[model samples]
Target: MTQSSSEEEEDKVEEDKVEEEKGEVEEEAEEKEHEEVEEEAEEKEDEEVDEAEEEEDEAEEEEDVVEEEAEEEDEEVDEAEEEEDKAEEEEDKAEEEDDRE
Candidate 1:
């Protein structure tokens, strides 16, 4: 009878150890899941920042194109004015030569 009681106690101890091991494993799994969630959130934020930067760069490039077009138009106007001045000078010289004759 005494030996049977001792065996029952041993069985109970073994059961308790198994239950503790399972609890530890469950805790580890929960911690891993939490870390994964945090990592995913950080990655999403980084992607959003990259997208915003890309948009800003595109806007700056568009502004540069507009400024370059304006400069080209100014150059065209200056060229046209210079041509008119040269024509006026030539006409005055021709009139002076005719008067001398």
Candidate 2:
């Protein structure tokens, strides 16, 4: 009877140790899962930031193109006005000569 009691005591101790180890392993796994989730969130945020920056760059480029086109149109208008002024001056000179004749 005494030997059987000792064996039963050893079995209970072994079960306790196994339960403790299992608890530790579960805790570690939960911590790892939490860390992985945080890393994934950070990665997603970085991707969003990159996309925003790309969009901003594209918008700036488009604005520069529009400004260039506006400048070109202004130059064309100035040239056309200069040509009109020259034509008017020639017409006025011809009229003066005919009046003298």
Candidate 3:
């Protein structure tokens, strides 16, 4: 009976060791899963930032194009005014010559 009790004790110790090893493996797997979740979240955040930057870039480009168009319109108005002034000058000169004649 004494020898049987010793054998049972040894068997119980082995069982405890196997349970501890299994627990360690499960804990390691859980840790890996947590790390994977964190990495995915970070990647998603980075992608959102990139998209925001792209939107800002596009907005700036559109503003530049609008400014260029406004400048072109102003230039066209100036040219038209110059042409009208030249036409008025020519009419005045022709009237003065007719009065002199």
Candidate 4:
């Protein structure tokens, strides 16, 4: 009976050691998974930041093009107004010449 009790105690000790090892392995796996998740999240955030920068660059380019077009339109309007004023001046001179004749 004494030998049987010693054997049983040894078996219980081994079982406890196996349970401890299993817990350690589970904890290590969880740590690795968490690290992988954090890396993936960081990568995703970097991609989003890159995309936002690209969109901002594109918007700035569009605004520049619009401003250039507006400036061109303003120049054309000024030219038209100058031509109209010159025509009116010429018409007034023609009337004065007719009255002098």
Candidate 5:
């Protein structure tokens, strides 16, 4: 009868150890899953920042092109005004010569 009682106590101790080991394994798996989720969130944020920067660069390039075109148009208008003034001066000189004759 004493031997039987000793065997029962040993079995109880083995069962407790097995339960503790299972709890530790479950905790480790939860921690690994949480870390992976955090890493994925960070990667998504980085991608958004890169896309914003690209859009700003494209807008700046478009503004530069518009300014260059405006400058070219202004130059053309100035040349046309100068040619009209020269024509008026020649017409006035011919009228003065006919009056002297």
Candidate 6:
């Protein structure tokens, strides 16, 4: 009976050791999964930041185009005014010559 009891104790110790190793393996797997999830989240955030910067650059380019168009319109208006002034000067000169005649 004593021999039988000693064998049973040895078996119980082996079972306990297996359980402890299994628990450790499960913990390591969980830690690896957590690290992977954090890395993916960081990558997504970086992508979002890049997208926002690109949009800002596009908006600035559009603003520059609008300003250039406005400057061209102002130049056209100035040219039209100068033409009208020349026409008025020619009419005054002709009237003065007629009065002298």
Ranking by TM-score: 3, 2, 4, 6, 5, 1
lDDT of 4 by residue, 1-101 (tens): 99999999999999999999999999999999999999999999999999999999999999999999999999999999999999999999999999999
Better of 1 and 3 by lDDT: 3
Writing each residue's lDDT as its tens digit, candidate 6 over 1-101 gives: 99989999999999999999999999999999999999999999999999999999999999999999999999999999999999999999999999999
lDDT of 3 at 43: 100
Higher TM-score: candidate 3 or 4? 3
Q: How high is the lDDT of residue 62 in model 6?
A: 99
- lDDT of all predictions, in order shown? 0.96, 0.98, 0.99, 0.99, 0.90, 0.95
For residues 41-93, could you state the per-residue lDDT of candidate 1 as single tens digits? 99999999999999999999999999999999999999999999999999999
Candidate 5 C-alpha lDDT tens digits along 1-101: 88988999888898889999999999999999999999999999999999999999999999999999999999899888889888888888899998999
Candidate 3 has what TM-score? Answer: 0.86
TM-score per candidate, in order?
Answer: 0.69, 0.84, 0.86, 0.82, 0.72, 0.79
Candidate 1 segments exceeding 4 Å error: 1-5, 84-101
- Candidate 5 RMSD computed on C-alpha atoms after optimal superposition onto the true structure: 2.7
Q: List the residue pairs that clash in candidate 6.
A: none
Q: Which stretches of candidate 6 lie over 4 Å from their true place?
A: none
Clashing pairs in 5: none
Instruction: Tell me the deviation in Å of residue 45 in model 3.
Output: 0.8
RMSD for each model, in Å, please? 2.9, 1.7, 1.6, 1.8, 2.7, 2.1
State the local distance difference test value for candidate 5: 0.90
Please give the lDDT score at residue 74 for candidate 4. Answer: 100
Candidate 6 TM-score versus the reference: 0.79
Ranking by lDDT: 3, 4, 2, 1, 6, 5
